[model samples]
Target: MPDNGDLRGVESTPRRDAQVRVFAMPPSDNATPTQIVQGFLEALTSDDPQYKTARMYLTPRAAENWQPERSTTVLADGPDAAARAPVQDDDEHVAFTLTGREVATVDAQQAFSPSSGEYNKLLRLIRDAETRQWRIDIVPQGVVMGQSDFERNYMSVNKFYFASNTAGATRNEPPMAVADPVYVRSHVDPTTQMVRSLLAGPTTWLDPVVRSSFPTGTALAKGAGSLTPDDRGRLVVPLNGKAAEVGTGRCEEMAAQLLFTVRSPTPAVEEVELRSGDKELCSLAQESAEAVATRGSLHSPEYLYFLDEDQRAVRIAAGSDDTEPEPVPGALGEGEKQLRSVAVAWDEHTAAGVAVDGKSLYVGSLVSGGSLGEPVLRSTGKTEADRLTAPSWDARGGLWVADRNPAAPRLLLLEEGAGEPMEVRTPGLDGRIQSVRVAADGVRIALVVEKGDRRSLLIGRIERSRPDGGTAERSPVTVLELRSAAPELEQVTAMSWTGDSRLVVVGREKGGVEQMRYVEVDGSTPDIQQPAALTGVKAVTASPDDKVPLVAYSVDGIVRLPSASQWQKITKGTAPVYPG
Candidate 1:
């Protein structure tokens, strides 16, 4: 028990008659942090029910001090002090402050009055009137105790009153009942804790006052079991056995009953069996030879190649048990006259070949000495020359050849049975011709123009026929500007036309990465889709079918279209299609 004599001086004051009442309860040995704070709140506010009126008795200096582990003391002494003190009687008031080991006394006239706003702001400090038994305000000196590490050593002074027959009487008494003793546990201040109650056993023991205050049998109803921390800070339950598993997976049978408690339901575990008996369930064995063979033959064609040569073409057709190329006698240019090179025409009937002389252009016939007909020969209107670049016949049987001459670099479109060869002039194309390919539509021809050190692939369309009716006028149009796209090309070795007028030019890019860019000539921005970044890509040509664009390099031959996936190796060594 506290010394009641310490408050005796204030009780005998002239202006006010006061009595100090004190009550002390033994602390429970197993009392939690929450229970201690809750018990304190209930003991303080047992008499005063309205919290708003109860706040007026607290002084401002006491409320402002919040130092942890240190005791705060407020001496109520100043002008208007009597008005700020708690009213004890009709003609008397009382003033008090907490000090070291004692609650000190003061004259009512010397007390200070806090502002109305300040008094109302102190309402939150009440916490829960029904749970925590105490409502406290710390004095200035007491605030330091809360600021220290040993704050639990200090006890808060909470004021309370009891109803009496006398005009003013102060007697501290524990409330008749403390409801819902749950405290908001914080390490900072014990007075600011919340209040909660734990189940003593499986059943509830309600206070008689609460039972009578409400309807009959209301207090006897079973209350919910709350999750609370035990002595070791591990969360445990007040109830044992299956009742302890309310929110856990073991309570699956009670799922439907507590459906509303499904906010954070426990997770379920799925069991998987790896083995059943002693026999191997999932074995790790070396793959059998037969199984490897089945997997290898699953793909349609392991290797695909183009039989460009006549002799090799016959062999590839006979070697494969799969579908073979139809043997149309007049389908492809045939017969042996020492065929040096063969280029597939964009259209079927018009394949052009060159002999060992490299001058005369053979269109649709490989007979020597004009055995089949008059062969299209290259001439500068000076002499009929034999040495020539690759030859290609257009859809109208007009033979187009790239003549090797700097002074008169010409792309001739000559008539097969005509009297003299006609010159098809392309302005701004005076350089030597490296390669040429007629477009699939047969209206335009793609040419690789070499001027000095620079090389460009130009698409030339046959604009008009010659005035003498001997050759067509070929005007060169810049489809892909090689200087802008690939500036480091020493020479454009090969060119091919993909469908939709997209020219796929294979040449050396800036960093020496062999590049292939598909450029659309129909006035759209060129989409430079580099299929593969490879080296030594010498020549590229699209299949006449256009459905499959086959790209043939020096090392790897016959690459497919769409995805440009690599095909089986054709030649063992790297050799040019027409080797010197």
Candidate 2:
């Protein structure tokens, strides 16, 4: 139906401003005040360094005082509602109010944390007498951007810190390093930004539980710019000469920290070489660093365990050789005691469970003919919803449980034997904890809390306090510093700590479907991988090792992902569990 096969007018008309490139356009001599403000906002989305060109929209005096690095405020879409037409009072004066919801904030130190509430930024514009163009005169101290622009402009990288490797660490376990997540500019070399954030210190949330082996005040040697590796895949990091004061053991530890942190974003780096000025101080190969710096390395379990239709614990062989489900020889596995949830120890030597009746927690050995111990913990909840949650065991052999009894909710830690369970206080907790999963480091606990009918995921740091009196004083007591870790997620149903600082959680955004995704403990961003394909998931479990596939319970049966080519059904199971 086109004349002369032209077909020029077949489509509908495009938007008037569709071809306009706001970021590329500078203020014309006759540009209005609002146009200048819009241009400035668009320029912020560019990858330009120091925002030199963007500064051209501002008066020289305002440009000299405005500091974008002081803070960053993230806003939602439809920034038009936040923008206003400038009201001019005089030839040189105009003002407008820019409003938005502050989703997150990046401080001057580059630490990213969740922040909420409506922010109203006052914009004062002035007409330059010389150029006869509108320029930003007085603005908020920080930069404001919409969510889409924020995601495209900023990225996240994790800095590594080590557990204390000093004299008191348990001999059975190799030294381990934990990850601290931070946000930085996506255009800049993340390797250098990550290293700089590493030197600055851990975010306040993780500062208590993690420690950096790099000595205090340690920094990149003066004159060094970005981090880059040599032809041999060796990343050479130049530290200020102050590092020379530490001994060889300390140097290796510091190298391990750098090796893990740098290799995270730059997988091409095979080894890390630490230097003071021009002198090489130490070097650590990836293999050697893995022994000391890695956490949650993959080690397949002897069997993939879950609860069968009979509410009994059962096991199926893990790895290539898939086997039919079989009940273990222990009492808990025999179905005499009904169970609602279960947890297994890393050694596969012990198992813990919550009774179906919702009042008792039992711990027993997994070995054949092993007797089920007496109920080590009992819940005081009066309702089914208030009953005991799933129990978890830390690497140190301590069992943890949350009794969501509305009358007396508490998080209790039970020792291996029949020792009295100590109540772990979660300070700053404003709601009842529905579930708790302790990290392998034994210093962080992932909790699902219910506040005002909404469930939120939280990370709490476990701190120990010793008696001040004598060497033979009372046993140390553990306390929790609880904080909201995932403000972006509105309703979190179930969660599992998969790595040092990553959690795979089943949650839904406002008015969205319930789905599973990997989120950092700091809640700065989601994992790069798209949320895994899963449906009808009632509960999910994953091994501490990230390489292993995740296990989940759906209406069909128990299923393992990517491990069996598809969601292979294991059996009619309820709760699938793995060692922490």
What TM-score number comes out for model 2?
A: 0.88
Cα RMSD of predicted structure 2:
6.8
TM-score between model 1 and native: 0.37
**Candidate 2 lDDT, tens digit per residue, 1-580?**
4358644555686654332122345666677777888887777777765777678888889889989878888887624423355365465777778877778888876767778888886888877777677888887886878888788778777677865422126555556677777778776577888788888888777677678888889999998988988888999888997786777777888888787778777778999888897688888898887555556543456777788888999887654346478986587798768999888887788888889888988888877777776788887777888989888877667888889999899888875524788787677888898888988766678999999968999888777665556673334545566666777678888888775568888888888898888877777666467446778888888766766777888877887775435666666888888775
The global C-alpha lDDT for each of the candidates, from Candidate 1 onward, is: 0.34, 0.76
Question: Distance from true position, residue 460, model 2, in Å?
Answer: 1.5
Give stretches of model 2 more than 4 Å off.
Answer: 1-31, 81-90, 129-133, 164-168, 297-302, 319-323, 328-331, 334-336, 416-418, 468-481, 486-490, 509-512, 525-527, 563-566
TM-score per candidate: 0.37, 0.88
